[model samples]
Target: MSSTTSRRTNPVDIIVALIGAAMFGLVLYLRSIEVSWYPVLLLVAAYLVFAYLFFRRQGGFGGVANPKDFYTGIVLLAVCGVFAAGMFDLPLGRVARPGVAFFPLMLLVLLFIFAVAILLSGLRNRGEALGPVPWRGLFIITGITVFFGATIKGLGFVPAIFVTGFVSCLASQKWTALSATTTAIVLTIFSWLIFIWGLGLPIALCGSWLRTALVALGVAGESIPFCY
Candidate 1:
């Protein structure tokens, strides 16, 4: 087929796009009015019905051929399940008081709606091929974050920040060890000054044991702020 033919606008695509835009506008309107969860739930049900019709018009479940769409749908569904589970015990406070659950629940509802839309779109547009996953980049980033979280408390703010930055930089093919190390040091110091000293956040700069040792040796005083 000619490129022009392949690129021709599909009515299904236009309809889905219009519906998505309308849904987004409705979300904004609902936000302004501070509507209750019950109404939002009703809207979600209505959207699902619309989504079902859209999917059916596109050729039903058998039409979905792209792996990307398959994975995206799975991820969105997983997220929806997690948020729904979390909402079970969450308190829906009054409009004036609006408990912690209020914002999360709203977000959850929006996510569910969007997820369904994405899944349906994927099913409709099954002509596209899936791209390769960047496993190396993904693993490196995930590992660096995990390491930072695991070691931050024991290693102190500066050290943890430095390590996180260095590792993250190394994840990219462009960064050399020396350049990454220098950048990491500069960033760690800069962040420490801003967030720890200036903002006076209550993060521990050093571990409890290290702080105790410093005090005993008279290198630092007990009254020194943990954050600094």
Candidate 2:
């Protein structure tokens, strides 16, 4: 493809890669500082990068000056500014709860704000500048996420993540053995941090279970006592 055609086909890929790298770095830094919700930030960056790349490759989100993009950007800007204002310097500590209602309330307001923004943009543009979202891969990915979240505790996080990654990648019809294995490893590490370390949740690794069994057998053998 010519440069222009390539640009038209995938203008957002570079942005997506950069965003992914930056977010990965951000989470690493945040974890080093013992910050809460680092995984949530990583999740947001993942979804954002995916959405941008997905839409651009499908058809550019109706071009650079697209109203939908502008509206989305505006709503995001408002969310940052308004939610911060609402959450900051509050006297909610004086109340019985001793904590601000800001976080939950901000989410509700932010959702409404985004809905309104999209509605207004659609109304103003009359769907002229916006294309239908490219959702072929998205639906499969969503299902994988749902399945992973629902089964992780019961199946073990590592196993659940491995299945999720393989299925998600395969759904894109772009999977090789190496890609599937790489995805599984990356997601397993992510699950270990987010569920095991960050949340203090017990999520056993399938490999670790085998290791435990071997250790138990070794200990049983060592009960001969003089070997200690």
Best by lDDT: 1
Pairing residues by index, what is the TM-score of model 1? 0.54
What's the lDDT for all of these models?
A: 0.71, 0.53
Model 2 lDDT tens row, 1-228: 222321231324344434544544443343223233335444564656665455545454443343553566566767766765665455333122334542443353345334433422332232234457648678888889999778755555567778887888877656798988898889878877887789977555543334445458885432332121
Q: Stretches of candidate 1 above 4 Å error?
A: 1-58, 66-70, 88-114, 127-130, 188-204, 209-228
Best by TM-score: 1
Error of 2 at 17 (Å): 39
Error of 2 at 28 (Å): 47
